[model samples]
Target: MSVPESEELCLDVSGGRSGQGPATWGQQAIWDAVSVLGDDAPRYNVSVGFELPAGRPRAAVLEALTRAARLHESLRTRLLPDGAGGLTQVLDAAGRFPVTVRGCEREDTERAGGQLLGELAALPFDCAGQWPLRIGLVEADGLVRYYAMALSHTAADGGGLRRLARDVVMLLDGVSPERLRELFPATQPLDQAAYQHSERGRKRDAASRKYWCAKLSEGPRGLFPPRGERVRDALFPNAVLHSPALLRAVDHVAAVRGVSGSSVLLAAAARQISLLGRAPEQLLQVVVNNRFLPGMSQTITTLAQEGLFHLRTVDEDFGDLVRRVHMSALGAYRYASYDKRLLDRDIEELRGRLPDLADHSCFFNDTREPELFRPPAGDTEVPPLERAAELTTLAWPVEFPPRKNLSFAMDVVDAPGALELAMTADSALIPRQDMESFLRGIEDAVVGDALATGCV
Candidate 1:
């Protein structure tokens, strides 16, 4: 990958009205961390790349991007600390979204483009200094071959990224600008914040608070104990355990137990953690896509939040355990959307009632997609996806706020044929061997149960 001389074009987009407002639940959660870590925490920054169809008009491509920036208010938004030591989202109604046109030789475009996409994704966002989005166009042989966009996680989430891709394709398909707005409109973060503060939103928050207080009243148990030598430099190692048989087993068990695949997987994970930690109870936070609200499904904004689920049981049947985990996840998902600051206050209040209440930061995130990305079929001559012009997501290690012990995250990616269960652990905590055992145990919990139930 090489970087040659590049020309910059700042395209000013219009439509959004300059305004200031409170952040959304997801954004607020990220802000809470940014307040302490600043630019060190890059987990909230997201990037995506798309291969443009070959022979497309360059002017049309540029126009589509300009319209996209205007369509999504979040792309034009930036956050600043309020006078009272909090964060406020400022929407730049008229913002100049720069698109750097970089030309790579046809032969080197593939390698250079991939490297550029990664570097763009890794670029840190200056929360207080700039807008939450970045756009780039990779061209070769006088034709644009690739387009990349990086947005702060505060602006959009995994689901929101897909929505952005869909909208851009629609624009390129020659949809009327006005009709496109009506079809795929941006839901400003301010509107989401207003809803969060509404009476209905308040009611839901109260319910969520009550549920969490009850769950954490007994205090958080240490799920993974640090042992042996620690890495001199703070680093985390992630390992993925993939198996087709285990995937089938998970589906079979879920079918037999009348639960979703997620429920079964969660149950298996909880069971494995309990056995590995050698504790009756295990504390694990589940990342939920808090998009249950009306219009939020298509509304591109930060909507991912953490849901706490504690699994404490001994000698329970796998099926019954799955049912219990399923019910717990239901509550967690329902209460996932809430102001992080208020939620922290509630946790502190609970401390008085339950003296043993402690915090456990280890979590589980299921980022599986039902189906992979399918390019939009259109009349335009879309370029073939080659080594140079490919579409994919980049995952990098995330840095958390200071004063961190061992933080583990179990991420699951579902594919058409198998399930990829990845266990990521801070090197200071469990050794490589233990992490491997925990992952294998999770696989066994599902496959073993399926075989026992004759469902496999």
Candidate 2:
């Protein structure tokens, strides 16, 4: 495959106003869209890619990108205010723009990712005219091509990425766009946001808040150096270096122990913290989505909340802690609708919190994508994907480097499961090995967290 000196990639934004300007979509609608995602809105991006037949045409690729953007009502959206206080995405009377394609260095895709992630970290976003996602076509020999797609986390999620890939394939094959639809569109994000505020939701919310309010007060326990450091530089893990046996152990333990892969992950993190913090009082914050609003299962918005666990790292059973962590996750998932911004009193305010909280650990579960969304192998036939051009997933930025004092962000991607741990810390205060040891502890906890608890 000849890497092109210049590549033509497209960026098409579905949710903003144009020529007729705000006439197409109102500000109220746009705000509502953003409001629904809460803090998760800014971090959202859906990406997927596929290979075309031996002789797939480049023109076909272009058409696929254009057609799919035109087809989805979501792509034609604008984040506007709902007038009362929240935000909603107003669909343009006409929902899409002809795809916008540009030519840049093959390296452009890489730089774009770094910059986009930084933007997500540095700014609180507004969706008007925002290009939340982008598409790239890379040459895969004369007749074959590959697609990479990237998006703003505010708009679509990993599941949405799967839909985008499937749709692009359908459109390229000449499927009519109108009849095209998501497998579970009713579970769209907007509907979920409404459920969060519903009466039934309130009951769930009360219980979750009480649990975390107590958990958040406890100190962190991990392999964190006294000066603190970021998770990425510390872990130095890009690919899985551990044995398959270890990864298999992670999965098997999660299942036998009645936990999600993420719960297992947090447990691992706790174990590492216990060793690193050196004291039993160390703390970390986990981010959980409140997206279970009844019907909105497939929506791409971020409905999230935080959970802080006071880990019994020194002498407790791993099984018990895993159960406690699992239960805490359930509670948080149920009530994440109540963003701290809306807490009943003064201390509950997000603004009132520390300016430095960004330095703490915030765990997110993208779920191992394929495992989270699919059924048993024979459950359903996944059709061959289509798109006019190759897609690219590197458009979004990576992240902003952390200041002194460290933090970690965990992401699960396509490769065999491995942690994409990111961190920020005072370089002068902590060395890199401290971070690696902390990450190893997280890995070790999956097997021995119970041992740590027993010692306590």
Candidate 3:
């Protein structure tokens, strides 16, 4: 495809609260992860695009963009190095944000928008020097057709992005900033940092640390014990399983069992890992959105952190396991917010006695929205496990250079009439064949149980 002609438009954004403070816990957590990737950290960038209404005025779009940039301090913030060898967040009250305007044929608008997204996201942000957000506009026949944005993970999580996107829509429809605030009030990062450093926040941090340390000491040192001398591989292999059967099975099971679909999937994954590694208990670092707290639901900043999930698997039935997982996940989410540095210190101390405590790096992240698991608006029957399994597809998509402190990781995402579970594992620990088996096994476990119970 040929490159489209493009020009730049600058929006002078100002008039938002600005200040400097220590990084929030979420910022610290993401920084730790990104710092490890170094040059590859651009992979953590979050990008999204939307089609514009027909004949939308460019001035209205620009106005909406400018208001949003001012409303969310994260959009105009920079992370600079603190003199003590740490990072500090500095939110600027005024800055000029440049929007790239690409001229493309109407038929190629979407493709060009995607190419523009890639161009904007391909480079790593100079956190200390540049703002955390990038914007692009795709125009055809002198009208704006689509808009795209690339943001640093430090600025927002999935929930934050959704909130910002919703606000932008409202702005385009002529909603006043004051009215928007009334409709969706949120706490900015600077204020959040102030509260986090207060006594109440300290208490929460302490409680979280105690909870995490107890779990760490109680769980097994490693999920997959060292088989023998280490055999290293150059890259980690990734496998994806798209199963409509699993989706229906999970929904049926969740409804009948009175649990969330996420718990059902987590239970199945825990069981599979236990059976594969010959371990009676499994420890996974599950990602927590941390949006349950009051006033946090609409905050436009990153607040996600890892919660330790420790579950023991014996001969228990799948139904019972799902209930237990639901309860355990609640506790994990409760303690998911904490000082990353403090937690690291506590873990380091615990490792003095439990040397292999850090060996386990299994992670589980569920990115599916709750509405996706809701049953269709009518009486629809779930296909049988055998029939549903026939439509399942599995593939190895890509490989990455070996990641440090990573053994196995799985992410749950939405698919058309299906649930997509993607897994990446160290080939040294889990061979490529085993990775395929693990994913398929999860599907079978969920679907077979749903069928056996006649839940459909």
Candidate 4:
């Protein structure tokens, strides 16, 4: 397949209330991460693609996009320095958003669309100057076949992306803007900023910080003791394990135990980490999606932040541990939202007394939707655990430069009839052997529990 030539175009979007305000908590959280990443900031961009109907008019698609950009203020917002080492979001009433167009054969639309999405996502957004949204279109036989987009994390998270995609599709189907607003009224970023800076918001922030600091002071100071020297081939090694048995086992356990699949997986991971570190307590930074809060379900902005998970390990069965995890998770989610700047200050102040306080650096993120863990429809039977386990595979995909204060990080993502666990660990603290064991242990722990409990 030859590379398709591309041309740049612009869609003129206008007519939203122009305003400026301090960045919302979500924006600030992502901005802090991006600042740490620096040149790797593009890795935070969210990309999505849609296949357009045959014979879809380019003009109609452009119009729908224009309406979507106008409807979501985050799409038109830019971040600028506020002179006091802070960020201010500036929402413009009108601007031109660039769109990359590629003409390709019908058979090549999929490849072209994937390529376009990668190209669009590879570049870092100029958050201070450029709008946070980028678009690309693949045309075949004089009609639009596919469209791809890359959104800056400062503007949207996974939930926000879904809402934006839904609104654009509705608009493309000829829904009027007024009716669309009535159907899915969205809370703008400016509204969120206002509420977050209000007195009530300050109280919530303070409470969150207090909860976090308290946990930090009480939980394990480090997950792994530092090695005197590096031993692995890379500073940060990334590994992925795809396990179908783990998926089936997790589903069955979730159904029987009346807990979430995520809780099961989190408990398993915590167990392995405690065994490795020989610690009676485990502390993990769990990413929380804050859409459950009031007025945030349909908000078109980033609202994810890390919640502190502190687990005191005891001699208990896996089911009991899972229940404890479920309860602990509720508390973590409740205290997840706060001002990152204030929390940093609190941590710094505490570090003066407890020097090793900053050594605890383990993170867990589960990206699966809630509905995915539900019981299947009638007559659907889970396969035998041994049979599914036979198909498990492990691979070392990539290595990354050292991430600051990171010892171990685990991410759970959905795979076809399976669960994919990706891990990145500091090689000095956790060698490749331990990394493999950690990933495999999660699968084994879940599967073994399901079989032992006769859940499958």
Model 4 regions more than 4 Å off? 53-55, 175-180, 226-228, 231-234, 370-385, 452-456
lDDT of 4 by residue, 341-384 (tens): 99999999988987667345899998776461322234545567
Better of 2 and 4 by TM-score: 4
Please list the Cα RMSD from the true structure of every candidate, rounded to 1 decimal place. 6.2, 9.9, 3.0, 3.1
- Per-candidate local distance difference test: 0.72, 0.47, 0.83, 0.85
lDDT of 3: 0.83
- Residue 274's lDDT within candidate 2 is 61
Candidate 2 at residue 408, lDDT? 47
Residue 340 lDDT in model 3? Answer: 92
Summed over model 2, clashes come to 88
Model 1: CA > 4 A from native: 53-55, 105-109, 176-186, 225-234, 242-258, 314-317, 352-355, 371-407, 414-418, 426-429, 447-456
| Top lDDT prediction, candidate number | 4
TM-score for each predicted model, relative to the true structure:
0.83, 0.62, 0.92, 0.92
Task: Give per-residue CA lDDT, model 1, range 1-456, as digits (tens).
Answer: 336776788877778577878777778777776556655656557777767746356688888878877777778888887777567888887867657677887766666566667766777777678877777777888887777788777778887887787788788888765897686555578788888789988897888877777778764556666676765665576677765556567767888888878888888887776776667676677988776667676777888888877766744688889988888788678877777788889888777777676446678888753543533334534332221112222233354322364467788776434567777777566666777777777776787788788852
TM-score of 3: 0.92
lDDT of 1 at 6: 69
Which ten-residue region of model 1 has the weakest summed lDDT? 384-393
Q: Is candidate 1 or candidate 2 better by TM-score?
A: 1
